[model samples]
Target: MYQLPFTTVVESATSNTKKLELVVHPSVSSKFKRYLDIVGSLVGLLVLAILFIPIAIAIKIDSPGPIFFTQQRYGLQGRPFRIRKFRSMVTDAERLKSLVSNEANGLIFKNKNDFRVTKIGRFLRSTSLDELPQFWNVLVGEMSLVGTRPPTADEVMHYNQRHWQRLNVKPGLTGEWQVNGRSRVKDFEQIVDLDLQYQKKWYPLYDILLIAKTFYVIFGRIGAC
Candidate 1:
């Protein structure tokens, strides 16, 4: 494996070392990181701007509510950030969530034919068009073009210390789990494992590969919703 500029020691003389570990600065990959986020997001947002009009019209005709759905999710270092997505469910879906959450995988809540999903919601989710607003997050430096998926507050609370390493880099709009098997894979630990793989082996080339794979997955419409 390659080493970063600084060597991270587990502890100094005053404290006992639990396990020695190396920590890399997020800035190590800063240049390409910013480039991809800015350029890619800008292009993506432009495309979505063109596409959003039609989607918004469809959503409005299918349901009654605002055009967007904003929810709080944890970003790098467990920081709180609001993730924006097009509204895919009824306005009252959150209120009705608890009652219908019983069928969830215990870690992630998923229902293919969920009652909360509007006619347009199902298609948006299947096509992943609902996630287009996250490009705004990428443009603003809140997220990355490729990295670990951001976790919700509830998901973060359940995370263990080791799992926190996912926050070493900016969260992504698409990630290993999304491409690998999102709804099909329900093991939260396995998701963290994939995140750790990305963190430990991250490189500009790896990111490019993941991005290409993501595009394939998106257009292929595999493992979606």
Candidate 2:
């Protein structure tokens, strides 16, 4: 695995040694970036709060499940944490996952017309309103305002050393994979490349730019599905 910081900043796994070695990266301890995350998340939470009532009503009316969906996702250095989203699918979506064929290649999964998605869920997903609750994750420091998208445990389980490099930075609410083309990019390897690219170019300014770019991407609906 490449890295991400929380309890520890980063750890590198050498294929030859098969041992985890600690490697500190600048983004891990940048107080400036942390400050950005705090401020950004608070703002995001406020926005979510403002929109919660209506969104909740729509979700309840459209589906018979909880308003929010929380799933175990791997964070920086592959740590497990619950990533929250507005429920975008039927209650039994997880159980029925095997019935839906994955259109994406490699460790990740995706289906454009996933039958499980509720009508309101599609709107939430395309507009990214479904991800609002994750600001809490960013506020609490489990994620960043801008970083790689968090992956599920099963997806991480299948990661190779090259793919592990993406986790070197904390998962973000939006990032390279996100702004470039969310689920539109089907190949998992391309996603790894984007994540690594973010790691390479990361800085507080760059993070700010990505955060700014996210708004454009979302509103324009460039790559929601």
Candidate 3:
């Protein structure tokens, strides 16, 4: 793992007189984890390729916007990245955000009944198929198979110390929040706790377990979106 030069506050100023800039989670340097991400992302991309045509056609037929939605999101250590997903809402959804009521609390935002969702988008989210394009993010090494949920740029702006700690690991396609309650767990603080808990419980095998659980959660329709 490449360590950053001194850049943070006095909390990082140890006796060595060097400041620490970010959370240095052990998974960042795990060769095995990278190997798994490589193999899994390749396999996921293969699946995405097989399903892309149908999904794209469905989106085009059902909505006026582009097939994919791209947004700026905060990734590991507060870095910015363009996260992609199948477009599940109107193109002007961001502009209309204020009109929609946010049901979740804290820094995150959510509205289960958000009106911006199109008919086909509802199906995609319900089946979790809307997330397929993120396999590309994993292939490019911007994310992991199991890690914290990626936050929007706006969400990161409100983060304090504890919230920022969740950004230590790469974002994931499915994780603790995805499996635990996703929509059911509406509070951002609780999501932060879950992210930190995953860190404390992390290991290579633990990631595999989360992956398996992800399948169960998907099929069981435990937590959509």
Tell me the TM-score of each prediction against the true structure. Answer: 0.86, 0.90, 0.90
**Per-residue lDDT for 70 in model 2?**
82
lDDT (10s digit) by residue, model 3, range 58-139: 9999888799999887678766788889999999998999999989889877898999999999999988899899988888
RMSD of 1: 5.2
Residue 151 alpha-carbon offset, candidate 2, angstroms = 1.1
Candidate 1 total steric clashes? 0
Off by over 4 Å in 2: 1-22
Query: On TM-score, who's better, 1 or 3?
Result: 3
lDDT of 2 by residue, 127-171 (tens): 999999999999999998888889886776566667666777888
Q: Quote the lDDT for 108 in model 1.
A: 62
Tens digits of per-residue lDDT for model 1 on 66-118? 99999998776666789889999999998998767444454567776689999
User: What C-alpha lDDT do the candidate models reach, one value each?
Assistant: 0.77, 0.83, 0.83
Worst 10 residues of 1 by lDDT: 11-20
Error of 1 at 14 (Å): 28
- Give me the displacement of residue 75 in model 3, in angstroms: 1.1
For model 1 the TM-score comes to 0.86
Better of 1 and 3 by lDDT: 3
